[model samples]
Target: MAGIPHYYLYGEPGAGVDRDLLHIEPVRDRSGPNDWRIRPHAHPDHMQVMLVADGGGTIRMEDRTLAVPSPGVLVIPAGIVHQIDFDPGTDGHVITAALPCLAAAGAQDPALGRAAGQAAAYPLDGSGVDVAAAIEAFRSLQREFLWAAPGRRAAIIAQFSRILVLILRLSLIHRAPAIGAADHDLLVRYRALVEAQFRSHHPPAHYAALLAVTPARLNAACKARAGRTASDILHDRLVVEAKRYLIYTESSVAQVAHLTGFEDPAYFNRFFTRRVGCAPGAFRRQAAES
Candidate 1:
């Protein structure tokens, strides 16, 4: 009960995954080492990486306290309530990526999120880069993000993906499912379009019009292969995106409400609350206050 964090979920997400990358922040919290006991936290759509830089600490994952030290990487799956804080004399750095994006890139294929368990937090390349180098790299990327460097954003994304590959190779013993070459080009095209427009327009019909597929046929293909309706997939993606924004961003509830395509703040409040069981402001406040 010493150093756990808190999390808040935003919606009842449907099956099928969405890829949205979020904030890459670095924590060098020596000051809060004594005062920073994060209560157990959970979010429905996020997995995180905790890289320690200094001071050793205890991480309570579900019902356990795994010892974490500098140059150590802790992988936490989304939807599990866990907490981490100073073990006694250690301060550390953590890098958190949205689960959807890591799920898309980390594996040799997609679907790793559902398959890969929490143990995926071990070394990157047999634990890549040793502890010291990885810490430097993580810090470098965090610094670049803070600077808001011009072309560095894309570079950081690439580096982050590469880091995930290393973690996957070491952590998951199973190979990923392959995407075969078949008559699914149109479906692939539709998926790409949906990824780009999910935050702006989540209506499956909007994507169906873009892909020149009748709504019925689109739904059939999606449900058959992905076991989800096209509209459900769209909402799942949008909800995941909204959660990412809320967690990693300092944006206000109203700003987040508008950015996620909600026209009325009241409507957004009702929408997310209906699914997640809490108001938007309450979610943000709880997330920040933690």
Candidate 2:
């Protein structure tokens, strides 16, 4: 397959957006020009959050497609391939922040990191007032971004953090009960370790050693929180990167295997096919065709 496009945003090339802190804009400003359809692309160091106030449509992230309705939130993490098709006349706000900025924020609140660590959609439920308040927060963010008033930068950061916290609250309400704090911390740290060292091909035992926990304990934490074994979590991370490389780069299957941490191309092919239901070459071809 040929290279899939990478962009900073919809029209903005990845290299052109130099701001490392944040960028806020309305959805229509970018999507309007493209007939409201954003093609599949990946951002190397930015994470995006979209709050849908009025209309909605489908979001394609990696291999999963999600339907988002009005009064919803979608967070796209760095390095994930994603596309969005908005309904005509859709109205909403989109914020693209440097992944480092998010990482800094997450340092203060690890839950925030988990919420934004992947592509997720949260459709707001409850009284109209709750939804209206979330929309107002988006408008407030936009105003501060435009006016650039005194202390505007701080205000923007604060408002953005508030929005994330609010969404976290809503997500928790609709999802399963929270896990134990100790277990949750271990799980979060495990995920962080996997993100940083997946390319190095470290085993789950290495991660457990780094986290000062036994392999059984790490597996238990992962199972309690994500319903997956620690080894499965590690393998899933590798598979995700494999799919990204296959879809976005012009690299050959052997090169992709090497890049994703497999020294032997044959083993990589078998691993990918077992987890992704197709060989790397076929996955690339399918992404190109779709």
Candidate 3:
């Protein structure tokens, strides 16, 4: 596939330079002008947290599309290819900040750091979270971001950090079976390896060897942290990459299979169809028509 668009902000080309950058604006400011649709794009060096205070829609991340729950929050990590389609007149706030800013904020709380590092959506209604406190934090962040008052930077970071804490609380409530720190660390390492070597078609066992762990241990860690087997994680990464090529490129099915590390196009076809419940070509066509 051709290079996916990378922007500091959705339509703005080029990377951001400000290490302390923290931008907050109403969601409609950008989404409204574009008909409430944010096309597939990536931010190379920044992360975003969005609060959906009003209407909602769907978010397309890699190969999956998830409904955006209103009165919710979305944490999007840097370098994820995503698209957002919002219902008209959706009102909310989107906070875009440099990765360093988040890292610094998360330094004191590892859970907060972990929560902000992943892409997740949480609905505020009936979740037992302090929704009012979270909303007020967003409002406070917007005010601090808009002004040049003394200690503005500190105030912005403090408010944004509060939001992250709230998100972490919600995530814990919705999380799968809790995993120990070692297991979580192993899962993170495994995911990083998959991101680097997925196109090589390495088996999960190969990854386990590289991590100096047995296959059983690797699988156990992945299951505990991600609710998936080690093999499932590798296969899911492959499927996500295949979907990206199919949707964003003009490559034929055979070429896509080859690009995704399958020497036998027929095998790739079967694998994709079984996992996605549709042939690659059919999925592409459906994506285009939608």
| Backbone clashes under 3 angstroms, per model | 16, 0, 0
Segments in model 1 whose C-alpha atoms lie over 4 Å from true places: 1-19, 30-34, 107-117, 120-129, 169-234, 238-290
Over the stretch 83-114, how does candidate 2's per-residue lDDT look in tens digits? 88999878799988875456655666878777
lDDT of 2 at 142: 90
Scored by Cα lDDT, where does model 3 land?
0.80
The sequence of per-residue lDDT tens digits that candidate 3 reaches over residues 1-290 is 13567677778863433334568899999999999999887664567899999999998765557789899998776655679999999998998887557766777887887787667777999889878888889999999887889887678888888988987988887662332256656876787688768889898999999999999999987665455688887887788778878976999999999999999999999999998899999999997895
Q: Write down the lDDT that model 2 would get.
A: 0.76
Q: Number of clashing pairs, model 1?
A: 16
Candidate 3 runs further than 4 Å off: 14-19, 176-290
Pairing residues by index, what is the TM-score of model 3?
A: 0.61
lDDT of 1 by residue, 171-257 (tens): 554232222222133444555577667778657887878878788888876654344578776777667666767877888777888
Q: Model 2: which residue pairs collide?
A: none
lDDT of 1: 0.57
